[model samples]
Target: MALFVQPWPIFLSINYLGLQACFLRVFMKIKLNNVCIFPLAQILNCVVYCIFVAMAAGLPFLNPYKSTDDADFRHGVNFAVAGSTALPTEILASENILSPVTNSSLSVQLGWMSTHFNSTCKTRGGWCVNQIKYLSFFLKQSTYCVEKLKNSLFMVGEIGGNDYNYALLPGKSIEEVKKIVPNVVEAIKNAVRRVIHYGAVRVIVPGNFPIGCFPIYLTRFQTNDTAVYDEDQCLKELNDFSKYHNDNLRRAIKDLKNEFPNVVIVLFTIILIFCFVMLYTGFDVMSLQKACCGIGGNYNFSLTRMCGAGLPVCSNPNQHISWDGVHLTQEAYKFMTGWLIRNMLHKLQCSV
Candidate 1:
């Protein structure tokens, strides 16, 4: 899922310096239960960026999980589908919103995971009932599954972003979308619980990004009123909404930690890292609010003329942060993955 951008010689020094600093801080050999479980399963909503995260972690590219895939998950598998939401399609439909890209919501992804587990290993009762058939084989296989799950890291989301995206894109006010925050957070909480139930000892439930800083929202809600925009030139109200979501999500993670004292539940404060990247002096991002691959708007973004729709790409993508208005560029993901590894890798500690 790589986006090809011709390298610019002028920015080479800057990018190299940034990478050097990032590498010095991000030591990628951290282990979880004796396995380097950095090959994350379905992260946030970005399928392409998740690949970058895996790459940053120095793991092999994670193939999207298919129910038909053979029982070889040693390299891990990604169940994330782009544009999928935390809420069900029917639930969004009731709000007069639609998931234009996918019907594979969080629940659907969890179902895939359950199906994968079921196919991979039989229950204790089933093993007992069929002990006479293939006793040694089944016993070894079940033990393998248990150990695999116990060591594996499950990243639930930077999900529920699309729920608001869909609602807000079609003219839902910020207040109207705010009402769905609890439902969205609950859905994320339930996902964390489901993974825990399946033997996941380490889970990363990431909160939403600051939508106001994105080019998509910036373009869509452009205004002449200077008060609406923050010091970062992001929409103030939308960022506030993102904070509201993160605050609620943090409380939910705290509750999960209290409930499952034996499991490690990490709230990846992605928003903080994102803000740091934006505010960092050494990054050399020329336009923090404009899309590198979009056209014809204040933020160089248009709802109709999105990236990869034969739109004009920036000359130096490495110097830009936003990729296609909504998503971040590979450089941005690289920096972010580096920052995440440097900061939160220690926090992914297993419960003793």
Candidate 2:
């Protein structure tokens, strides 16, 4: 039951913190309406989540890779836009951009990388360019170059959650997210298509993680009344909305595959992502509603409390699923990568 992240240690001061109060005031009203019909709404929400997750579960990328090793592991790179959608690269320059890649964005498996690699190390003109950069640098390196290392490359072109967030940006509704999500998914699809245009043989088109489940969203939408649809848990409404997005994305994959049969296209399933998050937040059995890396009390999640110069760290890091309420802890990332290896690696071939 790694679905609940409990004892969400959010700080009380979050209401007064930057952006928190404004988002809460706006989103809470929305949640109040949605949560009022909670049970019925939640059921529908679960159904929608199930549809996409079921589809994702069937993907070849979701297959196991426990037996695979690093030597045969060709090269692996996480070329995701921290909060990107499947769209044009120039969009990053916009003032509205959230998960910016160039001067912003960029993410990591944190402790998973042995070296203290920079987060936005992959200069983001775009996710595709970033991968090509990785492919380029890898080939020019001495100890290990892309040419010598990559017998087969498993490029996880994407897994964008922030677009869904963009859809939720104050001015919009979940339905709006539904409308915009396909565009984002298409942007991702197009990215993969471009990769194939290059020499990448085996490519993985991972859809978004559960946006409904992110701690940040919950913190913003929570209400005193249980009636409204609590988006924090990623109830039926958000999941169903996201499902529609994935459904369209899956069909896009089919369309792309049919168009380019020679190139291998694997879709990363959400089960692994969900399971990974569950394991990280310990939500499978607990609620990581707040962040262990932050300070203060429950507001779901607040940057004021998250890890950095200002926040506090937990004595037992493993027990806390989120190092930052918005991101996963190193232990959580390790568990997720293990899940990925089990669920994706072998199918992409490369042996590991």
Candidate 3:
């Protein structure tokens, strides 16, 4: 839902030429460069040096890349990985999820940029680009990457939520935030249009997650009035607002699909999967409400003291959906990914 990370761990598992494959080639060129630019730059540099030393001693990046040419008789075979970070579990997850289909085959071509609405191109001041203006910038920088993938998938968003959050977090009412929905949807439509112009054929645009379920929202909007709460203890009105955005977004995608007849635009359905996961994993309202990693108040979230050194982490992260107030845990992301692969693969047109 607007989970901001250091960008090094960002990866999207996608299908290419009707086969399960890794898409890390796009990051390979910048692999060394990212080590210097990311937040843990110094630590990564030390690790990079060690890798170079090991490589110099004859450890190759691709020890043995493998694939098969034989066509299957019945079902389609897909690939994926899970978990996080640099440890064995996380490394294995990254390796499986981000691995390429074949050694000789080129990796998926894609690019991404993380920034806010006012900064992307909305109301440009001096050197800054707003959300609307970011399209031109994206097109200029991403032509080569887009061109390389003859059959490409463009992920337009989990955006606009931040824009709404910008409005709401500063004490705006739900009605006021609702009024700005059109502007947000329009920006997304414009983004999809630009991507189509630059040759994206399949795009999977995700709607916002249930913002009402966020710990930040829960804590901020808390009231003694139990009537205002949902069964999950999230603010009912806020979740309704998120649903409003999804409704308009689906409508926009439908119109866009009709105009660009060849492009396959799908709205990623996240809410249903989230609800299903919570139930499937046996988490109740109390278990789901608090942050898995944080300190202080009822939601275990603080505006000043976030989850970091000296903060308390929950005994079991697997029981919690959120890692902190505003973000999901690695376990939660893994569950969602697996669920998406199983359910949305057909809708995404990745399965035959």
lDDT of each: 0.66, 0.41, 0.50
Judge candidate 2 against the unseen true structure and give its global Cα lDDT, from 0 to 1. 0.41
Give the per-residue lDDT digits (tens) of candidate 1, residues 145-228.
666666555667768899999999789999999988999889888888777786766666667889999999988889899999
Single out the weakest 10-residue window by summed lDDT for candidate 3: 2-11
Point out where model 1 deviates above 4 Å.
1-49, 56-58, 67-72, 124-128, 350-352
lDDT of 2 by residue, 1-352 (tens): 0000001000000000011111112111211111211132211211112112212222111111112333211112222223333443345225244544322121122112212112212323356756575666533342232222223333333444555555474446775456556666666565555445433455555555555555665566655656555433445455566667678778988998898887666665664476456744454245454555566545335634445565555565555555556665544544454445455545655331
| Structure candidate 1, residue pairs in collision | none
Q: Candidate 3 — which pairs collide? A: 22-99, 22-100, 120-129, 120-130, 120-131, 121-129, 121-130, 121-131, 122-130, 122-131
Candidate that would win on lDDT: 1
Candidate 3 lDDT tens digits, 1-352: 1111000111111111211231222221222321222233211211221122112222222110112444221111111111111112222233232312221111111122222111232323334455456757655545433443324344454556655665577677888768768866776676666546645566666677788888888888889999889886778998899999989999999999999987777777667677776668665457686887687778888767767667777786657777777766545655565554445446646533
- lDDT accuracy of residue 295 in candidate 2: 60
What overall lDDT, based on C-alpha atoms, would model 1 receive against the true structure? 0.66
Backbone collision count in every prediction? 0, 42, 10
